[model samples]
Target: MVKYLDTPGGFVTKAAASLTLDAGCEFGGGVDCGSQYFLGFMAYHRAWFLQDRLALTVGGGAITNPGRYLVLLPPINGTTAASGTPYFTANPGDRYRAWDFQVAADVIPRPFITFRVEFNHRAANVPYFSGPGGVTPPGGNQGAPGSLVDGWSPDLVKTENRLTGALMVKL
Candidate 1:
């Protein structure tokens, strides 16, 4: 679930939480039999615009998940095992945690159109980002259901840096 609340003093608050059943496929699909997966976070960022032309925003947050798959984070994909098996163990204690910081800039060149650029950095105890080769399937059906599989894991990094640019139009 997610919620957004507007408060006094020009401040807004955001929060969210989610749960995944049959986590890691440990013991079938029952709630008692299967492992439980959880993810939760809350963050707030206030936008400051200078004369309605330039805008800046800053925010930070933390995340915890098992093997990066159970979290419903925006613009992030989890790591999967090549053998069609659960990559992470069912133990809830095996979860990994991460913290993120972000800064964004917006240039409101016109009334209806705006340009944005954002920079983000995340640090985790375990590896995260993809390496140079990327995570693509190999050239053969390695016993996967109607698909090919590569018997290799991605080279994950502990720290990740991302830069994004977008053009938004008000309709």
Candidate 2:
């Protein structure tokens, strides 16, 4: 279940929880028998000043998954959710945990337009995020779509920090 609420004072809150039950499969198909659960929560507060021309937002969230069933697999060598890669696999009982904090400042020149800059810091218990080398292999993909090459591997890290800027327009 998931819930979101908009409270007074320009605050927004979100919470989510989920349960997944998988029965063991026959003929080596499907997920193993186990129960997986996830919980997450986040709160954001936005305050505007200078007669609503400038706004700032700050928020952070954390999540935990014991089985890593809902975690997103990095696209190494053009891997997809359906076509999983051999380099890494999230089996049953594997844990995946992550949290992120972000802050954004926006310049609202007009009601329909916004110029924003954001900075985020995210971390995980394991090497899950892409690193400086990125998740791609050398010389692009080879052999099978997501199959391992001769001696190349994806670059994954445990933490990530990024700054981004964007222009948003509403019509």
Measured by lDDT, the strongest candidate is 2
TM-score of each: 0.59, 0.78
Instruction: Please write out the lDDT profile of model 2 over residues 36-134, one tens digit for every residue.
Output: 556566666666666567777788888877666677778888888888877667676677778899899998899899999999999999988889988
Instruction: List where candidate 1 sits over 4 angstroms from the true fold.
Output: 1-39, 66-69, 72-91, 138-151
Count backbone overlaps in model 1.
0
| C-alpha lDDT (0 to 100) for residue 81 of candidate 1 | 43
**Could you tell me which residue pairs clash in candidate 1?**
none
The lDDT of each candidate is 0.53, 0.73
- What is candidate 2's CA lDDT for residue 24? 27
Please list the residue runs of candidate 2 whose C-alpha ends up more than 4 Å from where it truly belongs after superposition.
1-35
